[model samples]
Target chain A: SQQGEEDPQALSIQEGENATMNCSYKTSINNLQWYRQNSGRGLVHLILIRSNEREKHSGRLRVTLDTSKKSSSLLITASRAADTASYFCATEHDTSGSRLTFGEGTQLTVNP
Target chain B: DAGITQSPRYKITETGRQVTLMCHQTWSHSYMFWYRQDLGHGLRLIYYSAAADITDKGEVPDGYVVSRSKTENFPLTLESATRSQTSVYFCASSETGNTIYFGEGSWLTVV
Candidate 1:
């Protein structure tokens, strides 16, 4: 079963613009992680935010987690064409050990 | 090398045939997982192993079987190939389950 559900199934933005994607999960989680996948490539881990953390940043990627709302959001500042790919949000449920359930994913297309 | 590796990166099999996708990780991570990626499904876990000789089913494990005989090897097998089983398979491993590393992937086509 899918624990996380990402909003904005698809998004198209111009280069240098900011892109934001949201993910909502069904149950309590230990942590949430974001991953990026380019065309025909394996997924690359972007960032991870623990349940206690409200927000975390890495390079141009920012991730915020709201435990109360069971939701998390990923923001990419000054998006570049290279950032175009399918972004996925995975939740590690509190009860599931070493298991991460992924969302449908958000397909972001950055036009240069 | 020092990361997760998948063998038979691409394969085509006929219906009712048995197929196996091999995964080997040199990190010696205790936790390993198998996931399948489809067009709309993104990625779904098929099986996972906490350690050698221990395996469990995940979200979609109906026609699939997984075995982890060694700490570094986790292989997924399709008992009877079906068109629905055709998808890209990814193998991942993590020492503490906090961060996972994924293999390139294996493209399996069932006809």
Candidate 2:
């Protein structure tokens, strides 16, 4: 119920399994981005999906956006133990100027 | 060195002290931002600047201050640090509508 809200606050799965994270927003956005953070370090950009785009993929990552629903999902295929990290979804809404609002994030654990 | 860098990577200060965190970027991107990361809250934007001398507040800008005197430097200051302000601060920059990059982070503690 916020600008960017991600669910499944914590997730654990076996290596090679698929990990999916979902995000929802309350307003129209220009673009939505996914970021990964390991431990407590800085965040690393993973991918970005524009409001007009419905699906995008990069290597093992896949992101889908549905503007009508104002929601997005990120899927990591064949997950690896090194993929363990917190994933966050951020949105740059139409009225947010040049900044983005981030959600609480999903802590993913890939057990090898 | 190349990307974004934050100074005073770790800091400890009293409750009422004024603390400033310095941010510098080498890419000279036009958009810069300050965000505070907490345990349950994730990353909350504090301040941002589109260009020099033009700054705006973000989602949580209560006690934080920001000024972009130059294109490469954006600094955030806590006028009066509070225990609630103790969190990891991150500085980021991007070319308008592009991928944003983040600094390592500044771990601050207020006692």
DockQ metric, candidate 1: 0.66
| DockQ, each predicted model | 0.66, 0.67
> lDDT tens string, model 1, A43-104?
99999898889999999999999999999999999999999999999988854447998999
In model 2, residue pairs whose N, Cα or C atoms come closer than 3 Å (at least 3 residues apart or on different chains), thus clashing, are: none
Q: What is the C-alpha lDDT of each candidate?
A: 0.91, 0.92
TM-score of each: 0.97, 0.96
What's the residue-level lDDT of A110 in candidate 1? 98
lDDT of 2 by residue, A25-73 (tens): 9988899999999997899999999988999999999999999999999
Worst 10 residues of 1 chain A by lDDT: A91-100
Predicted model 1 interface RMSD: 1.7
Candidate 1 docks at the CAPRI level of medium
Model 2 clashes, total count: 0
- Consecutive 10-residue window with the lowest summed lDDT within model 2 chain A: A92-101
Candidate 2 lDDT over residue span B10-100, tens digit each:
9999999999999999998999999999875689889999899999888889998899999999999999999999999999999766688
